[model samples]
Target chain A: MIEAIRECLGQEMDADSRVVVIGEDVGVLGGVFRATDGLQARFGKERVVDMPLAEGVIVGSGIGLAMSGLRPVIELQFLGFGHQAFHQIGQQVARLRYRSQGRHALPLVIRSPFGGGVRTPELHSDAFEAFYTHTPGLKVVAPATAYDAKGLLAAAMESDDPVLYLEPLKGYRLTKDEVPDERYTVPLGKLRVARAGTAVTLIAWSAAVNVAERAAEELSEQGISVEVLDLRSLNPLDIDGIAESVSKTGRVAILHEAPLTGGFGGELVATIQQECFYSLEAPIIRISAPDTPYPLGGVEDLYIPDVDRVVDEVAALAKASA
Target chain B: MSESRFLPNFESIAPFSRLTESGILDSGESPMSDEAVLEALRYMTLTRVFDDKATSMQRQGRFGTFSSVRGQEASVVGAASALDPAKDWIVPQYREFPALIRHGYPIENFALYFMGNPKGGTIPANVNMLPMQISLAAQIPQATGLAWGLKMQGSDGVAITFFGDGASSEGDFHESLNLAGIVKAPVIFFLQNNGWAISTPRENQTAARSFAERAIGYGVEGVIVDGNDLLAVHEVTARAVAKARAGDGPTLIESVTYRTGAHNTADDPTRYIDQQELEKWQQKDPVERIKNYLRSRGIWNETLEQEMLDSCAAQIDEAMEIARNTPLATSDALFDHVYAEPPQRMLDQKLDWANRNGGAR
Candidate 1:
């Protein structure tokens, strides 16, 4: 996924002179994750510039660059670190176009990696997509696969509105898939059906998609065919796709690594009930981490919802509906 | 009690000034031409007139809550006049109607903004200015970025951002200055030390002797100007703009001024401000000081003042009429401009909203 992201960035920078990459350690250092490796050398220091450690300035300055006819792709290092820049991301970046009544086209992308199971430090693996998804005028996308990562990033850079492109931290090196060499975009606000089934549906995104796919395989052995839907975008949610899947299966389990209270899962559950109320044969179950801060590495496995948790919940939903 | 070793001795920096409080030239000849000074006086008068009318309209329920540019006209107009609207850009805080007007923003648009119309926020394509940023110090880094972009485009234009003494305390201010200093962005950090941020005084805002001195820590040139003296403000800003355009990097200009009026229409200055202090600031009113200077030079008189007042009132009336007659945006307008292409869910929600509100408008 990291190489794919770097390739897509190079392709875009090659295509557009206005596409500038700015972040802490993005220039000579090639970024902490090497997602921007060789960009500064190829594109020159002016295009791929290293920024100060301040997160607020990174995103805030990007807003100005975008306003001045430059497509700025800012890296926030980690999603947890974005809290320092929430004012810029949420208040200024999200509302600039709306507040300006569309006169200002902020063609900007804020990329960050998040989610647990990588044994990272505290605040390094939190899934805080809900904070951005709740902000109006922002398109929130979380790509679960390497192909989607490159495609979604391309689409985000091409977008006139600001986009929050969240990459799953664990999937950066672990997840692998065949991504096309040539440039292509996976349109945002759509869900990818990772697996097909009939008895039950599993809704997930980012790293959770891996867990959902694995759980589907386990459920299939027990004769409970499971459908796994990977929501690529969160803000402009794939509501139509979700409704279609829920109506087909009649049983659903929404999963995420974020805490239970006020997590994006609650929004998905509400949306499902609203759109597929009559089709639902059983109550929608929400599988999530507890309503506590992301703990240290020792208990992170217990904190994150694993394949066992998803499989158990899907099997219960299938049996209850049957 | 002994002084802590951490406390270091600092030198007191004097604010740059060209005119006395009595409107007499205190330094060398003014840098402004007679024609330019007259133009500045006209814009300052117009700003005062517009501000008064907007405040009155707000009280009469005709306009939205407004922040008046009452005593900060010289600081606002002086710095704004230094920019070339064709190339330079102004990223303004809320209290910059005078500057926006000087930069060629229409009076009708300003009136529309005070009337709570979103269209007012949209600047014409030709005008190189961002919308008024209500968030404190948020536009500082944006100004730096805009300046950097201009430099990258090989343009000689500079970007100037405005903020208050209160905003000087925000993290964005420090972060933006540090970044601009490192990159040598062609930008100007215009800080208006207006003595108060609502109820908090300038003393509470910072322990430093002057906000300008903070620039030394960022490796950026810093200057302090007597904001009430239009000549000093204009001279200091012009020098900074020239330096920025010449690729000498960013400059932090701390314009020392005061906000003699309420912070906004909803605020009551009587609550926290001392009457004696307000009275003293009133003596150094920027509008009166400029008017006095113009009169001393035989460029201004009672007849000229009446004509200016009449012209300003006529313009204000016309703009207010246009703003009053402008139709409000429809329900679907809310769904528009969020993205280049509205998502299916947004479209559905818009349809639902229209249906709920008795069909489309």
Candidate 2:
């Protein structure tokens, strides 16, 4: 996924001179994750800038750049660090176009990696997509596959509105697939059905999709057929797509790495029930982490919902409905 | 260990000025032409009239809550008058109607904005200015980015942003200055030290002697000017704009002034204000000082003052009438401008809202 992102950024910058990348260590350092590797050398220091270690300025200045006819892609080192810049991202970037009444178009992308798997420090693996998804003007997208990462990033850069592109930290190097050499865009606000079944449906996004796919395979071996839906876009949620799947399966389990209370899973549950109320044969289950801060590395595996948890929860829902 | 010994020695920055409180030309010859002075006087007078009308309208339930730019008219108008609207951009805070008016934003838009219309923020394409930022110091880095973007596009236009003393404490201010200094961005940080941030005084806002001195830490040129003196504010701003256009990097100009009125219609200055200080600042009223200077030059008289007052009053009355007659934004308008293309969910929600409200799609 990292290599795919780097390639997509190179292609976008090559196609548009107005496309600029600004962040901390995005220039000579090639970014902490190397997602912007060799960009500064190929595009020069002017296009790929290394901003100071200030998150507020990074996004705030990007707003100004976008206003001046430049498409700015901001690379936040981690999603946790974005709290320092929520004022810029939520208040300014998301509201500029709406506040200006279409006078100013802020075509900018704020990219960040999140979710726990690797033994990162505290606050490094936090998943806070719910906050951005709640913002009205922003389009929140979390790509669960390499092909989707590149394609969705291309689509995000081309978008006239602000996009929050969240890359799963666990999938950056672990998630792999065959990506086309030429450029291709995956349209946002759509869900991809990773697996097909009939008895139960598993709704997930980002790194949670991997867990759902694995759980589906295990469930199939047990004769409890499962359907896995990878929600690529969270804000402009594919409600119609979700409703179609839920009506087909009649049983559902929403999963995420965020805390249980007030997580995006709650919103999904509410939406699903409203859309698929008569079709639902069993109650929708939410498989999520506890409502606690992201703990230290040693016990994080216990904190994140694994495949067993998804399999167990879905199997119970399937049996109860049957 | 003595903490005093560890403290670094710093040179004190003196406030730059060209006009005295009595409107005397103190610093050699004036850089302003006779026509320019009259124009500045006219805008300053108009700002005062607008402020007074807005406050009155708010009290009479004819307008929404508004911030009064009563005593700091010279600081807002003088700095804005220095820009070439064709190329330069103005990024202003909320209390800058005078500057926005000088920069070609229609006076009626101000009425519409305070009346809670989103169309009020819709600046004309020809006007190189951002909408009024209500958030403190949030526009500083954006202004720097604008200047940086201009430089990258090979345009020589400079970007100037207005902020208050309270905003000087925000992290965006420090980060923007540090970034603009290193990149040599063509921008100006116009800090209006208007003595109070609601109830907090300037002394409590910062422990440093002057806000301008902090510029040294960022490796940028910093200067202070008597914000009440229109000549001083204009000279300093023009010089900074020239330097920025010449690729010399950003400058931080701290314009020292006072907000003699309440912070806004919701505020009552009588609660926390000192009578002695208010009386002293009233003596240095910017509009009165400029009028005195114009009168001393035989360029202003009773007839000219009456004409300016009548013209300003008529303009305000017409703008308010138009604002009152302008139709309120429809429910569908809320769903627009969020994105280039509305999503299916949004379209569905819009349809649902229209169905419930019995309105057209």
Over B272-333, each residue of candidate 1 has an lDDT whose tens digit, in order, gives 99999899999999989988888889888999999999998898889888888888756776
Please give the lDDT score for candidate 1: 0.90
Off by over 4 Å in 2: B1-12
Shift in Å, residue A221, candidate 1: 1.2
Query: Total clashing residue pairs per candidate?
Result: 0, 0
Lowest summed lDDT across 10 adjacent residues in model 1 chain A is found at A313-322
- The CAPRI-style docking tier of model 2 reads medium
TM-score of model 2 vs. true structure: 0.98
What is the TM-score of each predicted model, taking all chains together?
A: 0.97, 0.98
**What DockQ results for candidate 1?**
0.75
lDDT of 2 by residue, B119-197 (tens): 7777887888898998999999999999989988999999999999999999999999999999999999999999999
- Stretches off by above 4 angstroms in model 1 are B1-10, B356-358
Cα lDDT, model 2, residue A196: 91
Where is model 1 chain B poorest over a 10-residue stretch in terms of lDDT?
A: B1-10
